[model samples]
Target: MRRVPDVRPPALRPAAVLPGPAPRRGPVTVALAGAEFGWGSSGKLSAVLSALRERARLPLRFVGLASGLGRPLLAEHSVEHWYDLPDAAADRRAAVGRIVRSHGVRAAVVVLDGAIATALQAAGVPTVFVDSLPFLWTEGDRAALPLDATVYCAQQCVGLPPECEGILASVASLRWVEAVIGTPPAGSTGTPGTPGTRTWRKALVSLGGLGAPRLPDRTAYPRVVVPAVLDALAEHGVQEAHLAGNLPAGLLGGLVERPPAGLRVTAGPLPHSAFLSELTRCDVLLASPGLTTLLEAGRLGVPTVCLPPQNLSQIFNGRFHSRAVGVDVRVVWPENVFREEEALGLRAKGEDHALELIYGGIGRVAARADGTPGAAGLRAAVLAAVRRAAGGADWGALTAAVGTGGAAQVAEALLAIAGPTPARGA
Candidate 1:
């Protein structure tokens, strides 16, 4: 059994130290937070951190706000402080204000966690907000966002649907940016996927961040999606594959009676760097289509296929990938299960309403597998989608469509927001 990494930082006890007056000058403090939904926010946060470090004129002090689900992903970065955000709106604002005052936080970099960004600004801290899913937003989500953020960096997409317009227009200073994905290795001229037929030997199936707090049974996605994905990969001659994400325990042994193609499959969560390493080694990526992973794989020129999306943002991501590459690589539920567009239509009611349809459909399929109704048709749908991606795909087109300079772009914006004080804080 391959050991799954427990990447959360170890808690330390405060030790008494010789009392020395706090230094008058040091690194400028920057508070970071990603939406607790998944690893995408943390990935974007890490990329921006790297960019800030690379481009900083003065030393930087990094802290975290609401590192709940994203803590494992953020463990790799230098976030000296981590504070769990409160649930109540009033408490959340009070906690953020305390963090800002205590750390002397001058500016903040927030990805998707709109509430925290709004709170930071309430505390008089300038926030550079990253809205990666502008295409998925609606009027219902307006209150969560810091509409008057100092700098709201909305990622560029193929299209901003009607649902997003009102919320996007609400932002005070919205600046468009390229995909905020991790940078590729320097001087590496690796070709996309496998050469010739693109028959993949090693595969990576990413279920994305599965610990969605909304989900009662997070296993519903992996239990149903994994078997279908493994079947497809095996049929395509893949010999080895790694299933990456925060997944349920004993899911493989329980769900998959037989591992396809005599294939070796390892399931577990990976830190950002390790996940990128797996991307480089694999010939093809079959994933739940989180925007960050798609954009990163695009930068790496990796052949990619979209598994059924688990959320509103993912639906847009899968569609965006298909449009950019001119390939219908996304696997979606059957109409009998739930029409994708219909589910999307519920965005006005809130992301939860849209996700209810998606999750309910997936739950039905999973229940069917347990002899409730039947999951054969749903599994077959996924199988077909994976096979279609194998035919041939221009995966790099996504990268070309959205340049990979977003990290640097966000970093520059933060510096500008930080202004003369922090720039000269040293």
Candidate 2:
């Protein structure tokens, strides 16, 4: 087995043109919010907030209404103006209204949380709600009224509660398309096309979102699975396996000290943008079935092999992305990857499993480059929808209609309604 040197020779490609630095945009304020809730909720909410910040091309200000759990991480990108949550839900609504009116906001974009949606809707503000997780609720059930428009990431709401209703506007990623498109080219793997040093030539592994248990069987699953993946890759005659995502220090240090004969693992959390950039260079990815990572892999055109955690959410996510998107990949129990009936006893089941895995792997890799489906098309479509609703006039209606663009669209709508920056706020 051959190992890729930890270093690579620089690839002599033409320097990719960098977009001119993000222009500072305005006093047109919108809140990037989350329930001042738990870590899981905040992390999910932040992914949406980050996407909104990425798409806004014009000068703008973001006010965060929840706590700083997600905000501080975002401080490097732009100054976020946050509002404290009021004691009651009613007070929270009134507070948000005051903030919007004071800042002259035309739109409030909610990244598909029930509590956040309820607050903005109660305030009677025009809003664009980008619902990435349909399993949360159906559009009508979730939003009740015909929202100016709604956008969803998954195909129509399947597991959604009875309440959601709205036309399907677009499939948007919780991920920032800009993050993937802006990745720098990686240096070459000096080891050439040689097979890897261990049996596993190329391996990518991750435990999504801080290594918290994603499935019921998760606690012991990783312990059993990672070693199996390493062993299988070793058997396949690959040299090195790369580990990515949240890894505990003690366990990681232990792995490093003794180390698998030829395997190498890098530990520590990477800056979000940097991690996706590095993703361009990976051969295959192994991770818990998180929509964010799976979508990222799809965009990068990387083949993935997954072991679904035994939790309902992880199971649903794994099944959905694999079967629906028709990506080429494998999603199986750990036992399946190593079991041997040789061929006869479990022939049909084994064949079906192999086909699904291989098909998903090859299919997703062939789908498209990450971030290729530009948001411009959606923006144009949204503007048209808002215009028709407005009878070709500028009104606050556009805010409700443009759901996916979030900050950028809201800023545009505000420009249409409130006009340019004026003297000082009253």
Candidate 3:
């Protein structure tokens, strides 16, 4: 029998130095806690942590949860330590307490994991919650999660409750992109298309790390959507298309193996720098309503078309971003995916009291997939959006709205909350 290889990343340790004059103050450490659903959360966390470590200018130690998807990325980013938190509440609390005490952790940055956030707060560790979706806090009795600060990302997050303190910003992964791929010129729109020339447009199809999750089978939607998208792009004079996401190799291979005649489709996960480079060159980005990918595309001024979202939060994000930037953004979702009666039931239960839910319901109505329109209808919608995007997108307004220097701003906040570094006195 063949043995399965271990996919878990190895434990990380802090770098050691030769003996020298001991400083008066011990090292200051900060812990980051979040469950890695996909590359999005971990990518942002790594970028912020890297920025904080460099800018803080103190002896800093890093601790993070050893989530499978995030561990490798954290290791790649050189985080000092990774811990496996227990599932049980008491055990989780004890584990967090031990980490804080052992590492001398003064503060923590949590990415939308309420259990960890609550545990850290109970342990007397100052905690900052990095939230991407307004409704994520509504899950599993975590609505009352206490946070010292909350960092909201993208246009969808505007007007979220300002708990303790809030900093509105663009996708955090842009920091990583800027660090790796170099920043694009300010106010520069995407590459100009040759007018009246039937040139082949370059399109990128990235449906994000997990694809749509609310479906009965999360992976099924992409199989149907991708082929149809490729067909649409081919029909509309797109010759070279790349499909990049955190999809399994087998799934990606199936999609790329048989491309429409004269259309070359290459599918795989590209490194961060390479992915950003492709985004710069592509005329349009056909993607799922992932906040990271959407914000990145908006920041780069690439026109975008989002597949119907599997969940309510994504619905809100897609519509808000499309309207905010005047970009040719289209959100396509199957009509039957969400039932109106169920929605009414949720509203009746007072769940839609939050503005996020109310706005999301509006988005769902506007962007319904309506498969009765068939592949031809979907193709036309995609083609039209692409044509508009190829003309020019509102890169300047989108970038300005999202703001720059987000990494620096967040790092400064973290350092301030951490208080003065212990003095290295005589």
Among all candidates shown, the one with the greatest TM-score: 1
Q: What lDDT is obtained when candidate 1 is compared to the true structure?
A: 0.78
Per-residue lDDT, model 2, residue 369, is 62
**Ranking of models by TM-score:** 1, 3, 2
Instruction: Extract clashing residue pairs from model 3.
Output: 308-332, 333-369
Higher-lDDT candidate of 2 and 3: 3
Candidate 3 lDDT, 196-244, residue by residue in tens: 3234468899865453222233354556567778987898888899998
CA error at residue 133 for candidate 2, angstroms: 2.4
Model 1 per-residue lDDT tens digits across residues 371-400: 322356555666676677777677787776
Estimate TM-scores for all models.
0.88, 0.53, 0.72
- Superposed by TM-score, candidate 2 places the C-alpha of residue 320 at a distance from the truth, in angstroms, of 3.7
Scanning candidate 1 in windows of ten residues, the lowest lDDT window is 9-18
Candidate with better TM-score, 2 vs 3: 3
Listing every candidate in turn, what is its Cα RMSD in Å to the true structure after a full C-alpha superposition?
8.7, 17.3, 10.7
RMSD of 2: 17.3
Model 2 Cα lDDT, one tens digit per residue, 1-426: 121122211221111211345334445555555432212233334444454444444455666666444444344446456766665767867887777677666445554344555566556655544444444233324333223432222322223322222222322321111111112234521121122221224556666433322212222334434554554444444455666554445556544344456666555544445555556666555666655455445545454554543222444456544443333234444233322222112223322343334323323322446311222332233223222222211111111121223233332332333223433433
